[model samples]
Target: MSRNKQAKRPKLANEGFTGRLRFFVGRALLNIRQNAFVNIVTIGTITLAILIISLFMLVFVNLEGVANDWSKRVQVTAYFEQELAPEELATLKSRVLAIPGTDRVTYVSKEEAFKRFRERLKGQELLLEGITTDVLPSSVEISLKSASRNSDAVAVYVDRLKKVPGVTEVQHGEEWVRRYTTFMNFLRLAGLLLGSFLVLAVIFIVSNTIKLTIYSRKEELEILSLVGATRFFIKAPFLIEGILQGASGAGLALIILTGCYYAFLHNAGNFLSFNPAAAGLAFLPPVYSVGLFVSGVLLGFIGSATSLKRFVSV
Candidate 1:
């Protein structure tokens, strides 16, 4: 159908960029409809690949969020050698804030410390029957910056806090901190390896599928070449078609992903001990969602450009 439209328009005619692009897009749509089965198969395969990629990204993003939330709660507590005066506590807090990797400092008085302990032993108030405010040590809670959350960094920060005047000792969950950092590192590495693998796999699938489409239309391409059509002119419609297929597949994949995400949220409460929503489970953020669209466009362009290289000369 587009061949007939081109017959009257001639190959050498300058139709301008926008005009030619419009023609190419229209022709690409017509071609896809004509080869509906083949195009559907190609699009379906790509949709599945993109879906897997999107799903992996979703899980990784939420896991990273949960990790960040937990990591923020990791703090270094410094106990005072003796109870300090009001002015002394303020001065101590200011000095601890100046320490390397410190984000914030909160001074908990002996009274508050006992209060917290009492809250912890809510039902077992008997355990705190004789414990007085004087028995509890006043302490400063030093929160580390995000960059210094790792086990080694926390240990270094704790050591620095210990040297601060008036601080008798510092305690951070050293044992579990190392394990937590290790697990976070492993999660990051696995995400990188898996994401890269999925991206490469999808690109390969798209490239090969386009090549198949090219082979199916080989004769028409040969005819266009013999008729003196420029490489870009001859390749334009196919490139457009590839882009359209890629965009369609990506949209479909994202739609399915959103559906599955909502479905999981709706059902997560039925079987889980904890509330998924309360645990910080969430859909991909707006930025990441936009990235998927951009990724789709670039992937389409790459697949078509690569396929054209083998079939169309410079």
Candidate 2:
């Protein structure tokens, strides 16, 4: 009998953990069902907040992609002097290649340049009818390495290229690059500020929703407190409820985001002329999707905890 009682003790201890979890989860669902209208309002608010954040993330990610593409495309064109010898041109190529950030240098012959120009104006050959290959300039197109494509790095290369012998002109669109960089920086800052505001708004909405839930169960909580229930026992269900609310809201938001993504993809051709989608815009990556879901759960838990701190006196 003693051995049997000891064995039963371990079994009961194991059951206690599972039993507590079930109790908390069940109570959370019960509360949600009992306060369906309020829960719906809270969840809807969270959905809106998360959806706005997701849209911003989508835009930010794609714009960042476009910026990177533009950065990679930055090139420095060095037009050579009209009567340069082969040896001097070869020496010039070697010198340009020796620069630290130089990725690769392509020498475009005058004839090749003329051919490219003709191809560009294929339908309107009349524009080039009077043009000769000698009228075009033989230039070296310098593509910078990925690590050296920024404004400062490109400026260093531009200064170096200007002093190179046999080069009559060096062109790098410094003004345009600077303006683009500034625009992207402003966009990033705006997204961050807007996201922060939306998160705070979500917290406030959740807190108020939980506060009402607490009020509805005020008498029950007071009774439990008087009956000597531990603080953890009293608060566990509310915390769980908050988590559910947040997770459900995030799930809804993700569904909406997915729908929007597919819709955008389906109708992408219509907006191709005006939008970045023309250049193969993609949805947020998997890691960011997971992050959004985690953020939602954390936000809900935080909001619930804040409300509980005010209402749960014990």
Candidate 3:
């Protein structure tokens, strides 16, 4: 008897695994086949949602990148007074560069500034022919150590810059910078709100899809319940079905995203000449792709779990 029981243990374990596998696979296929229309709709909705999410994430990241670059390169143009001497302007440039957060101060001589102005007015050579170095002011162009969109930090620098000698004007459009940051902040917030709405929408669509599939098998579920089957035993298959649906949908979305990115790179290669890999405009990374896929799968399972809870409760 002892030998027989030990032998039966291995058989039982194998049977259990095989049964579970069959149960899950059977339900997954049944769900897919039975609710073809609704399932397709759900997948479509999920794909659209993920695509929007991918695009917004790309835009937001690049916007933040460009903002940082602009901030770091935010030039504080310090124009000198008309009567300011060249020696005094040179001394002022040296002092300004010595300050903390000051990366470099380029002194734009009056002659160099006039030449640039003439170059810019290439077509209207007659208009700029009489222009001399005296017409352009000597100035120090300031570059900061780090790019930042922080208003307080920018305000502090603005105050300090105004105090420098030979500084006729320290001009930077703080309001303009503030507005741009605010706009980006608004976009970030709007994306969050939209993402939440889309996620909730996908959950509902998936739940209804799973619910319809479960309803078609109401007889089987009822019979199991009648035969003393536990809720876990009855719901396990449906849960697995939902997971399959979610995973498939995520995989499809990833494929679409990859294709779109590749197409963009291929077609827009000329515009992307400045950056070989187009560092500024890039697709979502592998980590994010995996995360999104997992999220979709989990959402499917959770939606199924929630929808099944009511039936089990009864």
Candidate 4:
């Protein structure tokens, strides 16, 4: 080959990458600008769906947190019988402490319990006049390690506590805890069901929008095919279009979400001293946000390609 032609070859190849990228971006932009109304509609639909999903995800996450906090606060107070001797009471306390799943056990003497009652009824002198420490029952407060906090598991420990001397009542209910757990489970299930429906709707909306765009350009695609243009060359611009749509939709959604977070936080802060860390707002994780943008673009692109495939085969 001639030196001039050989030197031109490297430059041409280098230009190919830059040239193709620019061409793809230019074409995508042209199409978007030309079909501005359609693009806006497409973006709006996807944005609404994404917003609903993000809000639900935030609510469910915080609900789970609240439920967990309630569960952690759940404890048992074992009341002691008055006739029990000092040695028997000490032995009972030791045994209760040794029970499996028990984390920390606290003893509430009758005097302390009576003092609490007096303070509770501090303003009601008539009610407090006959009340005394001797009338108050001594009790032990039990906090279980997480694993042992379940109703069924705690029941076994409660049974063991009942068998100990001087133990009158072992208080922890299966029904109450079970109800709360069931409610939390329902929240999680509902979130999943709603989230799945929203995702499907987004995909369908995005895909249909792409299909319409493809149909509008059917004549151009056919001409490209007639000229012996390869499928990749024909499809590259559309794929880029999809990516741009995804990225833009995601970016827009994030901006809206950020505004919401700040507004809600601002309102909360005004009413009550709000700690930003504790609230854990409806903000998408960075990775998920990036994925959302990429996914949107891919969804648009793929839908376009799939719609075009039927026309291309001819």
lDDT over C-alpha atoms for residue 223 of model 4: 94
Candidate 2's residue-wise lDDT over 13-34, tens digit each? 2157888899889988998898
C-alpha lDDT score of every prediction, in listed order: 0.84, 0.82, 0.72, 0.74
Candidate number with the higher TM-score (3 or 4): 4
* Model 2 ranges with Cα > 4 A deviation: 1-16, 67-73, 81-104, 118-137, 145-150, 160-169, 267-279
- lDDT measured at residue 77 in model 3 versus the true structure, 0 to 100: 76
Pairs of colliding residues, candidate 2: none
- Between candidates 1 and 2, the one scoring higher on TM-score is 1
Per-prediction TM-score, please? Answer: 0.90, 0.76, 0.66, 0.70
lDDT of 3 by residue, 71-156 (tens): 66455678877645778766776788766667778878788788888889888889876556798887777777664445656667
Query: Could you tell which candidate, 2 or 3, scores higher by TM-score?
Result: 2
Q: Which of the numbered candidates is closest to the native, going by highest lDDT?
A: 1
TM value for model 2: 0.76
Pick the TM-score winner.
1
Give the winner by TM-score: 1 or 4: 1
The candidate with the higher lDDT, 2 or 4, is 2
Q: Which ten residues in a row have the lowest lDDT in candidate 3?
A: 5-14
- The worst-scoring run of ten residues by lDDT in candidate 2 lies at 5-14
- The number of clashing residue pairs in model 1 is 0
